[model samples]
Target: MSISADSIKAFYKDGFIMIEMNKGVEIRFPVSQNRRLAVGTPEQLNNIEISPFGLHWPELDEDLSFKGLAAGDFGQHSGCPTRNRRPRAVAGR
Candidate 1:
């Protein structure tokens, strides 16, 4: 099944990005996980465009798919490197 985002928000102060899914699911991850997001300022990070399938940050020129995010694949160019491993998804509250 394909999951999509209803809305996305970047919490710069908390250093996390949160996505509210169409089915009332919320996924949150650290900003440090994505290279572009890690370095983005509050203004830039907050500029999110949500599509049916994913989220986009035009100011940072970054995109993250809902499927990928659900699978814990932040990005290929993540700020923090993992050793051939995928982090577990954080369930919504």
Candidate 2:
């Protein structure tokens, strides 16, 4: 994992730092062990989310779920950009 000094600094402070990658360039960090995830528009790509090992695009209002990503289908989903923050929990059917 290639990390810059600034990234290191953010990690030390808030435990995370977003990295805005340039368009057309291959992402250095592994999104999910070789599976490259790219947002279609600059509005999507402009915001970067850097967690301990996850990213959250706030502009998109989408929580990029990453655990057990490749093994299941959720990882392959490109969530639609949303602006609502309503609870999505559902009761037992």
Candidate 3:
């Protein structure tokens, strides 16, 4: 599924990044869940630029994709605990 965010806002008090999609769906996630935005200050988070593909915070140098957010991804890369993947089984177990 493809999603494009029409607007985004930083809710500093709640520590959430709120995104409004083109289809009128809103998605939100804790700032701490995202690696780059995890340590950003209120001022840094407030300074955001919204694009058709994603959101960019030039001050904090953080970018989040709309589709990824819609899919429950908050910028955690491979090996990150938030991925929620189970360990593979051994062949000879």
Candidate 4:
């Protein structure tokens, strides 16, 4: 329910606050205005590149930037980075 000096220091440094509130962490990785890499305390937080403002899911093998996530531009689509809007399919192709 509370945070300490040491942990707070780590928070600004890593941008991800590891809080023991229930079965998860209050991680706000990616210090962007709107981009927040929310993940579980133990599992979801890891497995990705630990950045102060971003994360890389090794299992998913994907990376996400703050701006990208904010604008919803990039992310895992069919296990790959795809456009946010669907491409128009040809008619009667």
Top model by TM-score, which number? 1
lDDT of all predictions, in order shown?
0.74, 0.36, 0.71, 0.41
Q: Which has the greatest lDDT?
A: 1
* RMSD (Å) of each candidate, 1 decimal: 10.1, 11.5, 4.9, 11.5
Q: Write the per-residue lDDT of candidate 3 for residues 17-61, one digit (tens) a residue.
A: 876544466778888887778878888887878776777889778
Please give, for residues 1-93, the per-residue lDDT of candidate 1 as tens digits. 444433444334568887665456778888888888888998888788877778889989999887888888888456346646787889993
TM-score of each: 0.69, 0.32, 0.67, 0.32
Model 4, span 19-87: residue lDDT tens: 222334343434322123333233544444545455455644556554454455434433343435698
lDDT of 4: 0.41
Once all C-alphas are superposed, what RMSD does model 4 give against the true structure?
Answer: 11.5
lDDT of 2 by residue, 1-93 (tens): 333323421111122223333332222322332122343244444455655444555655544433432233323333433423587889994
- Those runs of model 2 whose alpha carbons end farther than 4 Å from true positions after fitting are 1-40, 72-93
Candidate 1, which segments miss by more than 4 Å at Cα? 1-13, 77-93
- Candidate 1 lDDT trough over 10 residues, lowest sum: 3-12
Q: How many backbone clashes does candidate 3 have?
A: 0
Worst 10 residues of 2 by lDDT: 8-17
Q: For model 3, which pairs clash?
A: none
